[model samples]
Target: MSRHGTAARLSFYYAALFTAVGAHMPFWPLWLKDKGLGATDIGLIMAATYLTKIMVGPAAGHLVDRHGDRRHPMSLLAAGATLVWLLFSLVDGFGPILAVTVLAVGLWSGIFPLGESLAMMETQRHRLDYGRVRLWGSLTFIASAIATGSLLTRQPSAVMVWVVAAALGLTALACWCLPTSVAAGRGKAPATPLWPLLKHPVFLAFLATTSVGTASHTVYYAFATIHWQAAGIDGDTIGLLWAEGVIAEVVLFAFSGWVVGKLGPGRLLIIATCAGMVRWLGLGMFTAIPALAAFQLLHAATFGCAHLGAMHFIARAVPPTLSARAQGMLSAVAMGAAPGLMSPLAGRLYESLGSSAFFVMTGLSLVGAGLALFLARRWDGGTIV
Candidate 1:
């Protein structure tokens, strides 16, 4: 295929994948509440989804590396995800819903990391810019989130399942169009086990920094709308708030190439970690303040910059063949395990400590910033590749 054709196909895949997340993330918890789940029950169910991803992502990564055919596993999993969602639409209780979520998310979550591996592989093959191509996903995420949020305001919570299912089905279709050449040929290089990598100081630092930085967002993800509602913000206003953060994220992605070039990955990480400290503090304490408009803008750095830094770190730190594994490991650590473990804690802390949970997150972000600074010294002084 021509380079332009390849890029177009990959961009479509990203749009579909991110749209799937946009459908689920903002609305899923609300749907659970609609089903009569309490706050703690909602948090537990969501945590279960992340827990499944942590357990399943590495195994899926290993399979992709072993079989050397990204298409087969990815397609099968996407199909399974679609089926799981279809099943979920029928279930009414916490037990059935949680069971389906675990099954569906365990398979559904693997699609992105594997798709990313394919995108990077194509970028390497065609000398295309990975950031430029990858940014499309961020754009799609914002667009879809806004559209879905608006739809929810007019429609029932049941619509969320249909939106999610449709997105996953489209994702599977996009996966089918991925370049067959890159899809085949599982390299014979022995799989580097995750344990040894976890033991490495640099990797541990990366894990810790990412865990703390991302954990800061857990409260916002799990309870932002609820908190805002309690504070007298209307549902529509809460949706706007969430959309605004994503819009800022989209803008950051649009400029990611220049941003990465000017600041470098390590410095960007430090900035993101610092921004996390400010963001959680703002949300935890000053969310009711009109000045929150200014603080919410920091989402660009907190999520956008942090994710960009992590992607670059994985790209630079690991070889191309192991890129899938590295991304998988990062997702499992940062998104899966860290959030899975920290989210419930954040919920509990919010119950007893109230907004002081932000102070805890603030301290964690400071630690992450310090670690990023150390990594800057370690990685900046040396050749990253």
Candidate 2:
């Protein structure tokens, strides 16, 4: 496939996928609340979903690596996710919702690492700018958040699941639009076990850095919308607040190549940790519009830079044949286990301390900064295995 064609397909997949995410991430807690679940219950449900990613990601990676295909598996997973979300309309209480969400997220989580592996492969082969293509997802995310937030104003929170289900259906279709195949040797056994990568000091540091940095957002992701709403910020404004962070993220992705070149992954991760510390601290102490707006912009550095750093690190440090697996491990640690473990604690903290829960997140950023420093010192800017 032509580079432009491949980029377009990947962009469509991202856009479709994140359209569901943009709605689900900010407002799903609201939906749970509307269904009469408390903050702790919402926290448990969110944590369960996050934890499922740990198992699903690596297992899916192993499957894709063996078959040397991502598109088909991604489509199947998307279809499963859509079906699960549609089933949500039938489930009313916390236990049923939790069970369905865990299943849905397990299937849904696998798609991201596979898609990222494909995107990075294209970046290497075709000189495709990963950031430019990824920006489309961020843009769609902004639009979805704003639109869904507006919808919630007139419609009930029950509308959230259906919108996400529709988006997931589009995502399944988009997966078929991806380039027909990856470069892996189809039907070949993986040459090495994942154990070496698991035990490697540098890889461990890399995980700790990205995982802690990303986990710093657990409290915010679980409670920010609810907190803002409780403070009389209104759903539309809360949507705008979410949009503002991703707008910054989109801008960063648009210029990611330049930034990645200038700073490298290590420095980028460090920057993310620093930005996260400041952002979380500010969020904990203030609820005023100006303070909230200013802190949200730091998301560019916190999430945008951290993600760019991890992707580039994997692209540079890991072999092509192992790309999907590496991406899965990264996702499992950074987005899965760390955040999964943190969510319940974050829920309890948010319930008891309200906005003060952000203070705990700031400490996570500090730990991530220290790990990033270690990674920068140990890594020689070359492939690890």
Candidate 3:
């Protein structure tokens, strides 16, 4: 393929992947409710997906790195995920549904880290802008979430399976379009255990900071729609709020090159961590206020800043050959395990303490900020490779 063709195909792939997540993240809980699962059950089911990702994600990454063929694995996983979602559409009861959700999520989560590894590999090879390509994913996510929310307002929850299945099928098709052979050497290094990576203090600090910051968003992800509904916001308004956050993210992603030049990765991490502290605090306390409409705009920094900082840091802190593994570890730890462990805890806290649960999230954000500060100090002398 021509260089432009390759980039266009990859961008489309990412767009489809993010659209799938956009459909799944905000609406899956509602689907669970439609299947007769209560809040606790929904939380457990969601937690199960995360738990499986923590285990499966690293393995998938290791496979991609060792085999040096992301496309095939990605395609297989996407197809399996689509099948699981289709199965979900068939089952009605909680027991069967939870079983299906676990399988589906476990398989589904494998696609992204692998796909991201491929994108970063391409970026490194071609000197392309990762942010520019990734921004489309954010844009598609925002668009899909709003469109899906509108669809759900008129359609029953059963349509979620169809929506997700279509997205997953597109993901599989995209993966098939990706190159099959590794661009770099495929020879295996002795399987370096993830333990050594974890032992690096700066890396650990990076992990902690990003993980805690991400975990702070769990309540909003898991319950923000329900919360807004209770506060008398209509479904369409809730959809707008969700889209507002991603719209800000898309804008941030567009300007990430400038942001990276100005702030550097270290300072960006600190900014993201600090903004996250405020974001969660705002969600906890001022969500009911009209002013929060403006505060939600900070999602650009809360998610976008933190994510870009982490990816850039990973590129700097680890070797190119290990880039996929590094990202997988972050996904396993930060996105997968931390939230997996915390979601149930947050659910309990939300039930007991209600909106005050934001206090817990706020405290986690403070911890993340502290970790970011520590990483900034530790890696200050190092240069990005």
Q: Which stretches of model 3 miss by more than 4 angstroms?
A: 180-185, 188-195, 287-289, 381-385
Task: Estimate the TM-score of every prediction.
Answer: 0.92, 0.98, 0.94
lDDT of 3 by residue, 145-243 (tens): 888889988999789889999999998888888865463555675244556776878788888888888888888788777777678776677777888
What tens digits encode model 1's per-residue C-alpha lDDT throughout 1-385? Answer: 8999989988888888888887788778889888998777787887887777686777776766665677777788888898788887789888998898888998898886787777777876887777778777777777777787788779998889989999999888888888864333345643554456656677677777887788777777877766776787765666667777877887887777788778877888899999988888888877664656677788899988888888777766766546677767777878788888877787777667766777888888898899888877766433233
Q: Which 10 successive residues of model 1 have the least lDDT summed?
A: 181-190
Ranking by TM-score: 2, 3, 1
* lDDT, candidate 2, 226-273, per-residue tens: 999889998899999999999999999999989999999999999999
Query: How do these models rank on lDDT, best leading?
Result: 2, 3, 1
> Which lDDT value does model 1 have at 178?
81
Scored against the true structure, residue 358 in model 2 reaches a CA lDDT of 97
Alpha-carbon RMSD to native, per candidate: 2.4, 1.0, 2.0
Q: What is the C-alpha local distance difference test score of each model?
A: 0.78, 0.90, 0.80
Q: Between the candidate structures 2 and 3, which one is better when assessed by TM-score?
A: 2
Q: Going through the candidates in order, what is the number of backbone clashes in each? A: 1, 0, 0
